[model samples]
Target: MALKELEVRYATKRSRDYKLADGEGLHLLVRPNGSKLWRMKYRFEGREKLLSFGAYPQLGLAEARLKRAAARLELAAGRDPGARPDRKPAMTFEKAARAWHEHRAASLDPGHAARTLARLERDAFPALGKTDIRAVTSADVLAMVRSVEARGALDVSRRLKQHVSQIYRFAIPHGWADTDPAAYLSDLLKPKPRVRHMARVGMEELPKLVQAIDAYDGEETPRRRAVTRAALLFTLFSWARTNETRLATWDEFEGLETAEPLWRVPAARMKMEREHLVPLSTQAAALLVSLREISKTGFVFPGDKPNQPISQNTMIYGCYRMGYRGRQTVHGFRGLASTWANEAESYRPDWIEMALAHAERDEVRGAYNSALYLTPRRRMLQDWGNLVEHMVTSDAGVRRDDVEEVGPPLTAVA
Candidate 1:
């Protein structure tokens, strides 16, 4: 008999089992102990599956019907809820973001990834992260971005948009959300203004700057003195990105090769996403070898913790100690190299691009090849390093009278 609510309610607690069918594969089972339970019978992969809703009147008739309808829709979409024999409960954005962080944290320099996630949690998660992934919309994301923009942190707001887009993309592949709202809001959000690269110090100013750094005498703070000297020489010889070479570790380096020892930075740490072999001239190698003796613990330039590389702010403090306030920065070293390297025709345009880790200008070649030009790059770096060493010691023979030419390509065996 088709069971009604009143009939089932009026039934006294008898020592018998009763079966009640609600059609469309849903059934309610009333036990002898007066407990009512809901269950659904379905088939998938040629095997029968049973899904339980909950006990009534806890779940109630109306709620159970709604759940059954949703389950039927999932079945129609070819997803079997009963497929996973050991399914865990859903994870929240905070949990997912932490998991993403753990995997990506060590790839970059210290604390960058962690700081990014902390910002996301503090500014982003509070608004929409707690809500179920599927429930978030474009409006929700737009509002969060607008809030950041209102704070006058335009750069941060722009970055937040990218981070949120990454999170959304992360969520979509993991079945958390359907679309990335931030991806659609690019035109809607304010565009960040272009920032000019720091100007390279001119030849006339270079001598004065070098003289100032050389003549400066400060208290014997081992870490401060060593790191500052290292930064100055590193800027000259390496001619690589200040941030890239700043996070150097003992494990990453290989000893001097032939005339000048070349330090090969692993592809993982490089901005180019390819292995970079840097030519360490006599001056650069001497600086590194000396630094190794003092900072033998872990990093080449150890920080206050004595286990990590020197802090990013150390260069600023070093500049202050050197009696150069509002002069040039540690990063200004790259500008010096860039301007000089570009002026020299001996350096191939491609070699300069590779050294800078810039992508290939040729669309056809860039599409097929992503790795940086390593072979000619090694020679170019060596030439650049040698030039810097020559200039430092006031060697007139080291004049830029000749072009910077790359000798041959270096094949990395390992």
Candidate 2:
């Protein structure tokens, strides 16, 4: 059953591929296509595995035996040479993902860098992380993307797909990979899902909603009720995102009691992972002043648990309670302010955009100064805060006593 060089060269093609024995699990596979290939079987980690040497003729019997002996040596030393780190077979998706992330960590904002890994762990890693980078097919990458897509996270799906593509491209020059499986993946993508911005409300609805918020009496605990109200009002007055609002700490606020107040949201807390300065309107600063009284914990809006930030869903449910659940969102306050300012048309659009902390189209302008449009923004926020007070205090066909309590005594969804 031993494979001889002359005999293997003359071996006839079979209806199906058959192996010519060379003992020790090494064999010459005679394919129907008249090709002779060398292969060996071995074991590692209590599992049987296979390794390829080379094609016969080019890899004669003596050389094949040498390669097999080397492989067995590697196995005895507790190594799988078949999947060595230098080889394509050993390059795992998780390993490559780590490499790609680390390669750009220095340049990327820490928060963005952290989220990229977090997302890969959450969505891609569980499915294909251990798979060999070369072994991962386009179908494999698409399957991972579709899982996110099925949840209707269209933007997340797109972002994750781009990440997969980047991973493959990064691995290519490093020699751990050869093929770009993620290339041209968008062709296989399902129909574009609707663009879903965070749920937020317009100006006309802002006032009526505020009136309902005032009526929210939570179990008659005045401190908790007051904290909740202040949190939402603070979110509006600062035009900060829910996470920004909830996680805000007293130390981050400067000059709240002074003539000029500023809430400096650090890069770690921002979506873009950059430092943002929020010019506090009198109302916003006043809310923070009141908040400091009740909050012994550093977090401006402490959660039910001590010292922790408030639940992200707290304000959304507050909206739900006010019978404006669908009509308004905690984030909608930003949109409302934007709407009010743009309609005012008195301020420059760039200044308004800067106030909103939108990523500036001009990179130079975006990164130029943290307080690029401070004076005008202070005035804009003051005017907006005045509008908010009028909306909350004035009767806009919504009586305070008539509004319902927060979505029925349910535990706040964390």
Candidate 3:
């Protein structure tokens, strides 16, 4: 008789092992220890064989019957249902992709590598992960791309296709795949949107913005407020990206007490994947000293989470708190610094570019100019620091004219 689900559920263990047959070679093997295992008894080539279809509850009755039906089909085709295939198992798409990611991650930043793996797991894995690398058709890849695009994530969709193509490229060289299925998928995606620059205050308004940042006390604890304030000031004074500043650690700094304090940003953390040197001015170094007294984690601006730096939005929200939302961004400080320094005749354009860490276009020039202008860049930053300090100490509603009258001249560095 075919066993009812209730009977399977209520079946109790006896003092020994026993079998409850559901007919057609499908049965439940109930043991004395209250374990229910699914097994199939069949004959192939005049020889009797046994196949295990996992355990009960996990395998369930209907799924086990499905497995039995499939096994019967295999038997009809003259293939052994329990025997292993002669050839090796094919490499799965997930396996090939993970191998590629591991190889690719060595040259990538740790955070970037983690985000890439996360995108794969979230989007690609569910659709094509278990399929054989060679068996993944272009249509299958397109389906995954369209699924992401349907949700208004055109950028993610485009990047997903790129990553898929890269995976195939990695696979083909390893003999895991014969062709790149994702190679021609670029045209199928939507067009990329235009770039919009971040908002920032003009040179004339910088002093007022500086004053606002000084007075910002956005409903947080005194310690949290101080950390956010210091993060913003450091980013402004050094003109480093908020991402670089937020992720900074104590060991990245050197010679803080000396005349030549430096922040050595590791190659992995930088946008161009090259080591960058930020010459810290006295104001920037002083902020670090104050941060060291209250900082509880390894990060210079530690967040609420354990051992993690503050979020990239910490400084952005600080700007918002000072009523500058949509008028300024944390990254705008770089533009402001560039404009101020470039307008001044004393500061060299290359020195300003190096201070901003903009990648030099020519490779040979980039390599040759890597350490060429540290001294001049340091002098420029010190002048910038002095200007910022002067603004903070001056009147609350200070203007460009007032700053020009009382502060160090913009061209005073040279």
Candidate 4:
């Protein structure tokens, strides 16, 4: 007779061992040591196999029955119960993300790579870190994206989608899973809000900004003041990105072998991934020479911590201190330079873009190009700087036309 619950309980009390038969090849074994185990006997691939259903009592009879039902359903669908690849051990999403990051670490910028990894560790890992990769569905990914979006980290959510997509691609080639759940993430992501800081500073505001930056006194900390001052000036003259300038290392700058004792930025620090030549004007080169004495150890703008560059926030705080807070942004320096060149009419747009290390986005045009617009860009930067310098030092030379004629020049008076 098939074992009943009461008979099994009696057997356990008398002989300290009991066996209960669950219909359709399932059985429960309860031992004297109070251990219960679920086992399924089945045929697959022309062989008989016993599959363990995990610990009993801990999993409970109901849970064990549910697992048995799932296995039976698989068999009914003509799937092999023993040869099931889906049941094989799989990695958690967090583990997959790490594995993917490791493969591409060398190709990414250090700052960006670190931040990406840290974000995943903080946001995505705790909830889904332990789940098997193959078992994770599109719904799971959508849920994670929504969580990030709800927290007002929409940009992060977008980037996380890209990161997860890369992970899925990595998983596909490895035979881990057949589908990329992250593929649909683009449609699921919330649209990014328009940021108002995209505006470029007008020519009229350029001089006042320069003058404010120049005359502004920083904190009592001499190192802080000097570094902040240097960063502002470098932004004006170099037209480099905020991070590129702030993170400058002493090693990236090499004294030129030519006339004005210029300092060159290396390929790695530059956005174009190519070495940049900065023909330092007298004032610019002097600033570099002065900085070399104080910043001789490591970074040109070393933080309070040894060997690290000043935080990006330092330059931002300096902007606030100089009274250019909401009127402009740290990234506006690029716009100011680009706008000034456009208004000058003598400078080439491509030359300005090259100076800022922006490669032409037009793929066909970019593929055939290899020049770095050194001379024209240098002249444009100098001309722009001269205009700012002139306005800051004296008010008499300030031209009202510089501001009025900027975007679309009103038809020049006949």
Best by lDDT: 3
Better model by TM-score: candidate 3 vs candidate 4: 3
TM-score of candidate 3 to 2 decimals = 0.55
Tens digits of per-residue lDDT, candidate 4, 1-414, equal 443555433435224545578777778766555656677777766645566676555666667778888998988898866554656356667778789899988877666677778878877776556666765666677888899999999878877777777788898678654446677567767998885664445777776777666554665665566667667776776777787787776656555333444456666666555566665544455556556656746777767777788887887788888776776777888888787788779977778777767768785698688777767766776676566556556433323333221211111110
Winner by TM-score: 2
Q: Write the per-residue lDDT of candidate 3 for residues 293-321, one digit (tens) a residue.
A: 76777898888888989986888989999
TM-score of each: 0.52, 0.57, 0.55, 0.54
Kindly report which residue stretches of model 1 are placed more than 4 angstroms away from their true locations once superposed.
1-120, 130-135, 149-156, 166-179, 193-200, 207-227, 240-249, 256-282, 290-325, 345-370, 393-414
When sorted by lDDT, best at the front, the candidate numbers are 3, 2, 4, 1
Better of 1 and 4 by TM-score: 4
Alpha carbon lDDT of each predicted model: 0.63, 0.75, 0.81, 0.67
Residue 264 displacement (Å), model 4:
8.6
Each model's Cα RMSD: 16.0, 12.3, 18.0, 16.2
Clashing pairs in 1: 256-261, 257-261, 346-403, 346-404, 347-404, 375-409, 375-410
After superposition, the stretches of candidate 2 with alpha carbons farther than 4 Å from their true spots are 1-96, 109-111, 121-137, 147-156, 168-180, 190-219, 258-260, 264-277, 303-305, 308-328, 347-379, 389-414
Quality of model 1 by C-alpha lDDT: 0.63
Candidate 2 to truth, TM: 0.57
Cα error, candidate 2, residue 298 (Å) = 1.9
Give the clashing pairs for model 3. none
lDDT tens digits by residue: candidate 2, 231-318: 7777777788888888888899899888799999988877666788888887777667655656889898887897787787877877
